[model samples]
Target: MRGRNIKKAAYPYILWTALFVIAPMFLVMANAFSAADGSFTTANFARAFEPIYLAVMWRSVELAAVCTAICLLLGYPAAYFIARLRLKSRGALLFLVIVPMWMNFLLRTYAWLTILEKNGVINSALEFLGLPKLNLLYNSGAVVLGMVYNFLPFMILPLYTVLEKTDGTLVEAAQDLGASRAGVFFRVTLPLSLPGVLSGVTMVFMPAVTTFVESNLLGGNHFILIGNLIEQQFLTVYDWRFGSALSVILMLIILISMGAAELAGGAGEET
Candidate 1:
């Protein structure tokens, strides 16, 4: 009676989730194998493997990997500082991390557009100081910069969550045992903090890889990532089948990464 009662109320919510979330995903998967005569076929998956599309997918992976690495380098210090701060100031530091996310993502992207434009603020400042103007916009550098700027909070928040809960006594214990400050960090703190690191990497990377808007606006559509390509196929080219295939491929890649992250976390815990 108790178990039956327990499932009674929860079953509808599960039904709703499966109907909304799982249904769409299954439809997309079905679309991946869709045919002109409305019969199931593997042709779409075969078509998705073409060199041009594969290159676009690969480019997206490469860019996301590089941007995630940069976020780790920059965000680790920021998260660490926030973690080490006194209790009263920690809230302020977290607010700083959060405030940017509340701002419109498009507005943030547009702000970079202004700064990176040829005769914009940066160039104007350079000219005022008798320095050469830089051509920075519409390049891979700009794409990465915009991505890092937007996704930084995602990295810091996850890392900070882990770091804030860290045991300071362990770090101090390392230092008292003839270990240098750097050694204590690398040996003790870092090993313990891998969950946060993994969380940050996954958070920054998936969105960065799949973000079409930043690349379109900042990179000037000169470069194409998988997101941009998928957008073009669905909206511009009117190829839902191909686009669905791309979406499935992208989803699968994300799933694989998430699974790996879970495995990594489990492995860390085991060791």
Candidate 2:
């Protein structure tokens, strides 16, 4: 009776997943494999592999990779620093890092426009300093900047969590064995933090690769990533079959990347 009741309680969640998640995926797959007249086809996938679309895919991966690397480099240090701080100070700094995320994501991305526009804050500062105003908005750099600003905390939080839980005794033992600071860090601290690093990389890279808003708002029409291509297919071109194919391809890329990251993380842990 108790087990039946427990199963009954789970029915709502199961139904919700089926309705929202599974049903949409099924529709996308059905559309991807169907032609305009509803006949089965593989042409959509083939078309997505054309050089033009492939270029967009490559650009998306490249930008996402750069964003992930930047976040890792910047976040690792910040997380390590915070992990070593006194409890109260650490909490305060972490709160500050998280506060920006509490704002609407669109609002945060829009806020960059005021800072990066030709007649915006940075240019205004430059003008005040008798320097040339830079054309900072609507470029690849601006897109990257927006990605880094938004996704940085995702990288930092995981790293901080892992570093905070790291055993101090390992560090002490490494030092007692006469390891240099760099050696201790590289040999002990870094290896133990691999899980967090992998988690953060996955979290940041997935969204960064598929993001349309930052690229649209910051990159303008001059720069088009895979996400933009997909959006254009669905909304502008009204080609659901092609759009569904692109979505499936993107999903496969993310899944494969995640599997690779997991394998790499496991190998690091074993080593």
Candidate 3:
């Protein structure tokens, strides 16, 4: 009777998952394998894997990798520094990092657009100094910059959580053994933070790869990543099959990437 009641309590959650998560995925799979007229087909998958589309996918991965790396480089230090601060200061700094994310993502991207545009803030400042304007807007660099700006908090939060939770005793003991600061960080602190690093990398890279807004806003019309292509197919072209196929492929890639991250995290823990 008690087990039955427990199972009954889980029914709502199970139904919610079926209604939201499982149903949408089923719809996507059905559309991916169906034609516009509802006939079965595999052509969508074929088109999705075509040379041009594959190139777009590769570019997406490459840009996402770069963005993830930059976020890690910037975020890790920020997280570490914040972790080492006094409790009050740490809260304030961490709040600052998170506050930007509370704004709409599109608004944040639009803000970057203003900052990077030819006659925008940076260029205006440059002109004030009699310096030449940089071609900062509508480029790969701008796209990466926007991505890093938006996703950086994802990286920082995970790393900060891990670093802040790290036992001070281990670090103090290592110091007592005459370990240098660099040695302690490299051999102890960094290794201990591996789970956070892996989580941060996954969090940053996944959205970066699948983002269309940042690329569209910053990359202009010329730079078409996989996300843009998928958006085009679904919205502009009205090719649901192709769009669904691309979505499935992207989902698979993310699953693989997540698995790889888990393996890397496990290995780091062992080491």
Candidate 4:
């Protein structure tokens, strides 16, 4: 009776998932597989794979990969530093890392516009020093910078959680066995933190690949990534079928990437 009651309590959540999550996914699939006259078709998927659209997809993957690499490089050290700190200091620094995320995401991206525009903060500082104002905004570099800034914490927090829980005794044993600091870290710490590293990579890469806001705001019309292509199809060109196809393709790519990450993580754990 108690188990049945517990299952009953989950009914609302199941209903919510069906209504919001499953329904929308089904709708997208329906649109993806249908023509304008509502007849079933595969042309939308074929169109999504056209050379022009393929280039956009490639660019999106390239930028997302770069963003993920940067986040991993920067975040790993920061997370390690924090994990090694005293408890109170660790909490304080972690709080600082999370503070920016509390701000509205759009507002945070917009702030970069003020700092990166030709007449913005960086350029203004350079001009004050008699240096030439840079054309920083509306570029590929600006888009990557925005992605790194926003997604970095996602990388840091998971890594910190895993590193913090790492076995100190194992590290001490490695030192006792005459391992150098670098050797101990490479052999002990990194191997143990694989789960977090994989988690962080997935968290950062997935969003970065599909991010329209940062690319649209910072990249201008020069860099039309896959996300931007989908957005234009849906909103500007009013091609819902094509947009849905793009979304489905993106989803499949993400799922496959996630499966690979999961397998890697499991292998690491076994090793």
- The most accurate candidate by TM-score is 4
In model 3, which regions exceed 4 Å deviation? 1-10
TM-scores, in order shown?
0.91, 0.96, 0.94, 0.97
Cand. 4 Cα-lDDT = 0.95
Q: Which stretches of candidate 4 lie over 4 Å from their true place?
A: none
> Looking at candidate 3, what is the lDDT of residue 183?
85
Question: C-alpha displacement of 78 in model 4, angstroms?
Answer: 0.4
What count of clashes does model 4 give? 0
Clashes by residue pair, model 4: none
Per model, how many backbone clashes are there?
Answer: 0, 0, 0, 0
Per-residue CA lDDT of model 2 for 101-140, tens digit only, reads 9999989999998999989899999999999989899888
Q: What digit string (tens of lDDT, one per residue) describes model 1 on residues 79-197?
A: 99989989989999899889988889999999999999999999999999999999989988999999999999999999999988889899889999978989999888888989999
lDDT of 4 by residue, 146-198 (tens): 99999999999999999999999999999999999999999999998998999
Model 1: residues with Cα > 4 Å off, grouped in runs: 1-16
Error of 3 at 48 (Å): 1.3
Cα-based lDDT for every prediction: 0.90, 0.95, 0.95, 0.95
Pull out the clashing pairs in model 1.
none
Q: Give the C-alpha lDDT of model 3.
A: 0.95
Please give the RMSD to the true structure for each candidate, in Å: 2.2, 1.4, 1.7, 1.2
